[model samples]
Target chain A: MKALVHEEKTGTKGLSYREIAELEPNAGEVRVKLKTAGLNHRDIYTLQRHKPTDPPLIIGSDGAGVIDAVGDGVSDIQVGDEVLINPGLGWKEKSDAPPQGFEILGLPFHGTFAEHVVIPAENVVQKPQYLTWEEAGVLSLAALTAYRALFTRGQVQSGMKVLIPGIGSGVATFLLQFAKASGATVYVTSRSEEKCRKAVELGADKAIDSNGDWHEALGGEKMDLVIESVGAATFNKSLDQLRLGGTMVTFGASAGDVVQLNIRNFFYGQFNLLGSTMGSTEEHREMVQFIEKHQIRPIMDHMYPLSQFEQAFERMEKAAQLGKIGFHIR
Target chain B: MKALVHEEKTGTKGLSYREIAELEPNAGEVRVKLKTAGLNHRDIYTLQRHKPTDPPLIIGSDGAGVIDAVGDGVSDIQVGDEVLINPGLGWKEKSDAPPQGFEILGLPFHGTFAEHVVIPAENVVQKPQYLTWEEAGVLSLAALTAYRALFTRGQVQSGMKVLIPGIGSGVATFLLQFAKASGATVYVTSRSEEKCRKAVELGADKAIDSNGDWHEALGGEKMDLVIESVGAATFNKSLDQLRLGGTMVTFGASAGDVVQLNIRNFFYGQFNLLGSTMGSTEEHREMVQFIEKHQIRPIMDHMYPLSQFEQAFERMEKAAQLGKIGFHIR
Candidate 1:
């Protein structure tokens, strides 16, 4: 099986497109003939700094394919069923905290960056019928993250006002759609005016120029919830725009990590700051149902053959893409 | 009527004991002849810096007394009824956010420091028959803040592990009792060994020294919830002790307001940081009921006559007390 493997120690130069052995399903697992896979910043991080001396690794958390075989004890799913694989491991149910040893598929375990991958059988969910191969492959990670942050944690409801900052990421796009579909008025902030305009063309009610006076752009309307992924650059501003006792849910810190907090403003206004990551297996199933029901077509920026994995990585590094960048695996 | 007032603009010495015009109940109001009043840090803030030019404000928020008069339309509360005042003004119901104009009783409004106080009839709830006047007087503000932070915002439940840092404030003492009564294992931290010993004697599972090796003292036990009122001084350590996906509910920042947040740690660990002030009127009522059902007695440090207001203020400002300080106002 052909795989896009990061082989060197330095940078993007480490990526090597070559053949790798296909894995067979273990007990309670299934083999997937991956049709498409998504590229993410996590993949880039591994390629740049993860040394070759580390255990053999395959990188890619989002993928869509057909189940080629099922292991012993897998009774529900069958061979040749079209499916999307949830990358989260060890967290199969909703819990107040992730179970110990919880991890995302990709690094330590062989992932969908290859032509064929074997994952736990329970990770496979029937792909949303309305999505294309590329959309289904890229939707799991970002959509699940957005779903949990917006609905599960933020408890967004109809008539609530929601804000998503750094609107060009895949998760941010999904948040805009999810909030609007759930009947919330959505606002977005992006450094690129073109991206801002594009978001409004989608279901967002308004888009603000991130470099400009975005706070004033809201015209004094307070947000009921904020989906924050852009960390230091926008955290305080995002919090400032929330109405009293409103919530801000975060999943990423792309720009920087250390942020100064105004504790008095936080307590006096009774604000809630919640942190979220991907989601539970139940949420993944519900997310697929939601996307299919709403007919949400995940925004994809570009797709390349498995051989052009380096090109896709370069595009993501430059952040030149507006949405999920991907790979055609089969 | 005799009242304790902050007469000047500088420090605790500005507080004076004087005679003032007796209050008469307005429409929909009742006048209470105060028997006991609880002193808080907010009173110190007013005495230390609040300008004398502001309305003739009497400083105290927690009080229990006998209703002496009822104004027009005040049918529920009648003369000679024993009651405790819910000191939050303008917030009459549970809301996602406090309505505009919400204020505590002690700033622009004349408060419970006087021998007589006229407040809206709706603000009075029957005092629990099991409590002494001193306990009921001091319980309202601290218990309300702690109840909301623990049960309402933190979503605490039986069998959870709870941590309260910088113990010995009125709020901290209440949080310890509330968490313990709710079937949580409560741990506390304080710089003073005597205070820590006092907390363990009051049903806390364990007490750790705030300035010592407190983290090591926990011996790898992670907190499911943290009630954070000490703020900047212990914020980072408080967060470090929380389990992944645990919540930290903060009500006050007594040490300082400016704290550094490690955004990566927050999002990666999926932590929840929530801010809560005083609870709603509905929560106040519920808290009173819960206290009565549990037969909880609020911990009091010392009581001074109304004429000894300066000494009480000095004790609080110097951080010398372990629990609520108060005025015996009869």
Candidate 2:
């Protein structure tokens, strides 16, 4: 199998393309011949040596492909069936299952940044007919994330005001579309003027510049929900702009994780500060349903063949693209 | 008219035992001759000037008294009927109607720290016959607080483990009795060993200290509910000790208000951090039932005459008292 593997932590090509031995699937496992794999900022973080030190680490988390093989007692799928590998196999289909520590694809384990990756049968969801290979591959992470944070945890509702802090980030883009689909009033901010305009074109009710003072500009009326990926620097400001009893859903910490808040504001006005991680498997299924129903599409600035992996990493490191920048590995 | 006025930002003696102009009942108002007044920490906050200062601020919010006079067209009660003032009064009530915001006593409003308080007729809940003046007075804030935070917001259940950060704080005592009545495994903590032992006698399963590695002492078993009045320094420790999908209610920040948290922990684990100000008037009625049904008696530490208020406050300031430190004005 010709796969991208990080040898020594240097640059993006720290992952030198090489032919590696493909392993046989274990019992209850299925091997996926990847058609397309999505790249995320997390992959870039690992490339920059932000992740645990391990040579030959496989990087991509989200992907879609055809099933190549099914292990013993796997009555699940036959060869040639197209599917979406749920990026995180450890996400329990059973709601009552206990937590499986460190299971996200690409983070602590071998990932989809390869020609083939083996996973348990439960991690595979049938990709909807409406989506392309590239779309299905990328949808697992971003769409499901937005689904869980906004719907299940955030309890977002129709006709409510929702604010997303930045434009063109994968999660932010998905939030914009998903919120609109749910009948919420979506507002966004962007460091790039063009991205702001693009967000509005993509269903955001309003898009402001990066430095735009959202709290004051919105006057005394505050948002019902705030999707905060950027942290620290914007945390207090985010809390300030939420309506009394409104919730702030924090998923990422592009800024710093630690933040301080005035406790009185929470009690007197009734505010909730909710922290969210990735979607549970059930939430991911919901994501697929929502995306297929609303015809929501992820924004991919560029798509390349697996061979151009180095170039893709460079663009991602510089953030020179909008939304998820990825590669197909067939 | 006589009122215990705080002339300057000083302890106990700040209560200037002086005469002031009488305030007549305005429209929709009634004058009550107070029999018993409850003490909330907010009054202390006002005295110490931790809260914003405007001198001559009337103290006390929770009051049980006789309706001495009803202003024009006020027919809710005839002269001399016993009632408990609904301190947080947010809505108007019919003459034969129910009380509205009954739980928010001793906040910014002109409270009942004196012999007479003029408020709208709607601000009163008819006193149940079984309660004594002291029981009726103290039940409004602390008792209702525990009910709302534990059962209402925290949704505690029988056999569930509940952790209250303090042993004898006004709310903590009520929480201890309430959780025990609800069949919960109640745990309390205090800096004082004596206080911890006393709390165990008051129905706490265990009383941990706020000192040296108390979290490890909790055996890593997650709590179902944690009632937090102490804030900042203890928030993370509480969060860490909570199980997945556990609820932490923050109603007061006795230690400090500002706190930091990792948002992901809250969202992914389905952790809930609810901020409760004061429960509704219905909650006050519920607390009244709870107290009478449970025959719960507040832990009255000592009684000080109005003139000895400084001594009472000194006890509170030193955290020497296990229960409410009160002053009698009558």
Candidate 3:
């Protein structure tokens, strides 16, 4: 099987396309003949920071495929079933912590940037029928993150005001859609005017320039919830824009993590800063159902064949893509 | 009326004992002849930072007194009634934000540090009969902050592992009592061993040295909730000690507010950092009832006459007191 394998945990330069030994389903697992795979910033972090002591790794956390085989005692799912991988392994239900042995796909274990991947049978949910193969491939990681941050943590409601900062990423796009579909007044910010306009076109109530004064741009409309993945550069500003007692759910910190915060203002304003990651399996299923229910579709930027891995990496490195960048795997 | 006033916004040195104009009750307000007044860090902040534009400002937020007079339309409270001033004015009910014109007492308006303090009638709750005047005077601000942090934001539960960092402050002392009364396994940390020992004597399950390695001391017992008031120095360490999805409520930052945080760890752990301040009137009422129900006594460290306020402030500045410092007012 062909896979995009990193020989060393360096940077994109360490990535190479080569033939690797085909994987097989272990007990209670299923072999997925992946049709498509998606890129995420986590993959970039794993490449740049994972220790060299770590084993050679395949990178990718999201994918859609058909199951080729099922291992012993795998009774719920059958071979050839269309499914979406729940990327987050071992967190089967809602819990305060992910279960021991929990690892997202594509780090310690082989991931979807390969022709075939074996995952726990339980990690695969029947893919939402309304989504295309490309859409399903890119939806899980970003959609689940947005779902948990908005619904599970932020508790976003129909009339609540929501703000999504740095709105060009796959997760931010999905957040904009999910919040809009839920009847929230969605406000978005992006460094790129093009992305802001795109967000407004996709039902965002307002789109503001990230480089501008957000407080001035929003014009006194404070957010009840802020989905903040952009760190240091925008974190304090995000804090400033929340209504008293409002929540900011932070899942990623792409720019940097060193944030300057006035503890006095935070407490006096009564803010909640919640940290979130991937969702539980239950939330993953609900995310798929929610997208289906709202007819939500992943905003595709571009797709490349598995062979053009460097091109995909280059596009993401420049952040030139508006939405998800994918690889046609099969 | 005699009052402890800060004639300028220049730290504790600016505070002076002086005779000020006697205050009169306004429409829908009452004038209380303060019997005892408690010192809070917030009072210090006001003295140190609030503009001199509000000069001759009386300084103190927590007090118990006999209502000396009531203005017209003041129906719920009457003259000569004993009460504890809520301190947080204009926020009469639960709100995501304080009502317009919301302000803590002792800032722009004359506050409890004076011989007579005038406040809105709704801001006074009848003092609990079980409490000593000293206890009632010191209980409102700190107890309300702790109540909102633990029960309102932290959502603490019976048998949950709770950690209170920097455990010698008025609020930390009340938090320890409140959590213990609610059947929680309360753990405490303080730079001073004597304070830790005092916490244990007051029913804390364990007390650790804040300067020591807390993770090793706890022996793998992760905290479900952390009451964090010590800032910059302990914020990152507090994040490290919380169990996944745990909540940390921060209401003060005596150490400083600038702190280094690893964003990856925060989001991956799915922790919550909630910022709280003095609570609403409803919560203040609830706090008073809770104390009465539990028969919890406010920990009194020392007391001085109103003229010795500078010495009291010195004791607090040195962090020498284990609990609350109060002034015996007339």
The collision pairs in model 3 are none
- Candidates sorted by lDDT, descending order? 3, 1, 2
Error of 1 at B207 (Å): 0.4
| CA deviation > 4 Å runs, candidate 2 | A7-14, A45-55, A93-98, B8-14, B21-27, B48-55, B72-76, B91-109, B263-270
Model 2 DockQ reads 0.45
DockQ of each: 0.79, 0.45, 0.74
- In angstroms, how far off is B66's CA in candidate 3? 2.0
- Quality of candidate 1's docking, in CAPRI categories? medium
User: In angstroms, what RMSD does candidate 2 have relative to the true structure?
Assistant: 3.6
Clashing pairs for model 1 are: none
**lDDT (10s digit) by residue, model 2, range B1-330:** 666777655655557666766677887888888877767777777677623355475677677888888888887677888987777566232111123343344444566877788887777778878777776665576776677788767888998999988676778888888999999998778888999999988888888887746567776667988988888867777777777767788888878888877764555566777777666667767777777787888777776665565676677777687876565657
lDDT of each: 0.87, 0.76, 0.88
**TM-score of every candidate relative to the true structure:** 0.97, 0.91, 0.95
Better of 1 and 3 by DockQ: 1
Best by TM-score: 1
Model 1 chain B poorest ten-residue lDDT run: B6-15
- lDDT of each residue in B1-330, candidate 3, tens digit only: 788888765887778888889978879999999999999988877876667665567788889999989998988887789998889987777665576788888887778998989888988889889899999888888998899888888888999999998998999999999999999999999999899889999999999999999999889899999999988888878878898888889888999977766776889889888888878888888888899999999999998999988889889988888889998995
